[model samples]
Target chain A: MSGAHLLVRVGETTAALPAAAVRRVVRSLRLHPLPGAGEGLLGLAEFAGEPLAVLDLARLMGAAGVAGASPAVTVVTWIGPAGDRELVGLAVDEALEVAELDLGAAAAGAGEVLVAERPVRLVDLERLGEEA
Target chain B: MSPELVVVRRAGALWGVPAAAVAAIERGPEGVTVRLAGGRELGAEAVVGLSGEVSVRGLAPPVRRRLPPAVAGLALWNSEPVAVLGVAAAPAGGRR
Candidate 1:
């Protein structure tokens, strides 16, 4: 329990996602597909009549496959560019609760992170929207 | 209303089933027959309910569990409590 928040898994094993990057977690939804979309875009989903871009976090994390959209968590994040925030949706294996951790509590490596004492790939939320 | 279950057509064509539709969700070793929304009961090995949606992943055919708004409760597998989340229908495609 440091400055960084700890992630409570839906099942077992503690995984961490940046609190600042997450807006809210919701149940899985049918993602509307965008013609000629890239790899990360799970598809398009409408929330309250407003269309939202959904990104498959499980695929991005290498946890699941393309059809693994079922039983996933939708994390709405705001990507800011020059103070402009663009909203995006991320689908994960599950929505784990958030916990805070100290910045100096663990080691930090390039493209690598030891979150909550668990080794995981550090995701760059900012670059998530870019075409891969 | 309970959210709609998101369904998708996976990539890589295989016997009328796309590879994308084949999720890696775990089906229970001991499968159970479940009656879901569409008045259809399917035999599934394992099912996971989170937030409010119940998903029967890991099946070869890939069962997309849809929970209607009227249904609200914990999903029991082998008499154990599982995560429950809201369910919703994905757009025409899914995720992107």
Candidate 2:
């Protein structure tokens, strides 16, 4: 990655969502649970007096024990393709840091970015809306 | 134009039934009776009457496929989400 990425902790793993798409990393949101909502959706929350959909990032990554985890931050981001972007919130365990990393030797679709000798998955935000 | 909705607590979450789809709503000791225009009456709780201009956010396809058939979309009441109910979508009874 030649650009800045927002690194965060989702469950026990480190992941990155491009900084350009990240609008804010706020304190844990007071999310209103949606009854009968699927596991993917955390629930709706208020941001600037608007209802925002908050998704469980750890659950999307197939991480375990997300229900028991106390999410510390809500990463507000706009995902989806250009001109058709949708703003959504990601409930993550912690907000690490914004890092500038170089992935010159890795191939496209390799999925992992080397951060401090650890492999951090480059989160495919588009899938957040599409995934089951 | 968004129709006025009868926001009620049902099954589990807060649900909104279009006022146009409701024939009458009467509160008693049991709870609120959301009588539909089609002559079917369903029991609901915490009936918040005559909500106007409830802008709904259509559920994504993945979420839609998983939701109950009665759910139309999601909207807000005092900044909290209320599942907007389509016609004939109100819960029959019971808190699920």
Candidate 3:
């Protein structure tokens, strides 16, 4: 299926999220760590009067563990079906742009694609949120 | 004859995998996961690129002794030695 996708950089790789699942993109926001939050969960941030759970995409993807810096932006996303969705904020290095993606033609696992000759991984947001 | 290889950068070392054994290299939710010819998927930090052609030359055969459990053997590429990773030994979520 053809739909819009939000492209964001996580560490050295670029990843895409379904535009429909994304609420908005924001600059680095203060995150309050949640006690006992499991791995990959960065913390929580306030958005639309609600506490949005933030996740480190880099950590979730198990990329090279680089600890010196924090993500410079966040992509707020919602998971699950309508009316029962949960808000999540994904921390990323940069928010690139929205682009048209053919989900069918993308790679089977993680929906890989090439943009400007560089490979961009299209994340399965639903699966990612569920696993996290 | 030389073996065709795909060079990968994991942790801080370079590794080689026979190119024919790789089914697909895609971005995974947890990082770069390579689909092996056997259909198993494992995560990777970065895929350096294929080495094209590599000659074993004077290098000794991959020895069972003096090597880590995960490494299958040793080979020379660009005049340096690289570990031949046993992809099956890769962790569930890829190399940490």
Candidate 4:
């Protein structure tokens, strides 16, 4: 897969996750909530007979709540200690275009404004699993 | 080697879980829910409340609360006290 950064909005602010880390931006997928599941987890979905965990990115970043029937983009990254790839869906207010930027030039820790205006950070696919 | 751990900084505090312990990390109507190695799960309410970084109960604590020198370097993963599962007692010869 091409190495590019995906610019997305948690609410008003823009944040980026690596395009490579993202399996695909899906819409209108039925998100089922798991009993006693954590807050950030939207729920589990059976994609091709395999159950995948859906993650709420906005909830993770402390962003605004998504409105009803609004479109969301799911970024499926691998999780688990053994590097078992798990699909985690991030709920975003809007799905921005993908862009390619130099790693060094990509800003880090610039706060929400810088992220929306310019490429604020480099998305590390490996780290997503470790951190998620 | 153990599976890599993922570190997330929420609400100014850091927390980590064995990347393996995390079955999946997802955004929900509420907040970030981290599924553990087993079916057990924990919710980062702050992440759900959008309140920034906040702490919550996680996995069981390890028997050796203090990590050995060999694992000290891994302490960086403790951006916040991550929910850790306890280590089971080894058999006579250290067999699991």
RMSD of each: 15.2, 2.9, 20.4, 15.4
**Model with the higher DockQ, candidate 3 or 4:** 4
Q: Give the DockQ of candidate 3.
A: 0.01
- lDDT tens readout by residue for model 3, A1-132: 778999988878888899988988998676655333356666545565544556777776666432433458989887544444556677888889999987776855357877777787878765564443
* Model 3 ranges off by over 4 Å: A65-70, A81-84, A107-110, A129-132, B1-96
Please write out the lDDT profile of model 4 over residues A1-132, one tens digit for every residue.
224678876665576776766777777665544333445555544343333455566555555656653336665554332343334456677778787645544433432224335534343433332332
**lDDT of model 2 at position B74:** 74
lDDT of each model, Cα atoms only? 0.40, 0.73, 0.64, 0.45
Off by over 4 Å in 1: A1-15, A61-67, A80-82, A105-107, A115-117, A129-131, B1-96
Model 1 achieves a DockQ score of 0.02
Put down candidate 2 lDDT per residue, B41-64, tens digits, no spaces. Answer: 667766865688878766554456
Which consecutive 10 residues in model 4 chain A have the weakest lDDT in total? Answer: A107-116
Model 2, C-alpha of A115: deviation from truth (Å): 1.4
Docking class of 1: incorrect
Interface RMSD of each: 15.6, 2.8, 23.6, 15.1
**Candidate 1 lDDT over residue span A14-124, tens digit each:** 345567766666777655453344456555554534335566555545544434544366766655343444556666655555655444433445444455467554455
Evaluation by TM-score, superior candidate among 2 and 3: 2
List residue ranges in candidate 2 displaced over 4 A. A67-70, A81-84, A101-109, B39-42, B61-66, B88-94
* Better by TM-score, candidate 4 or 1: 4
Classified by CAPRI criteria, candidate 3 counts as incorrect
Q: Return the candidate ranking by TM-score, descending.
A: 2, 3, 4, 1
DockQ, ranked from best to worst: 2, 4, 1, 3
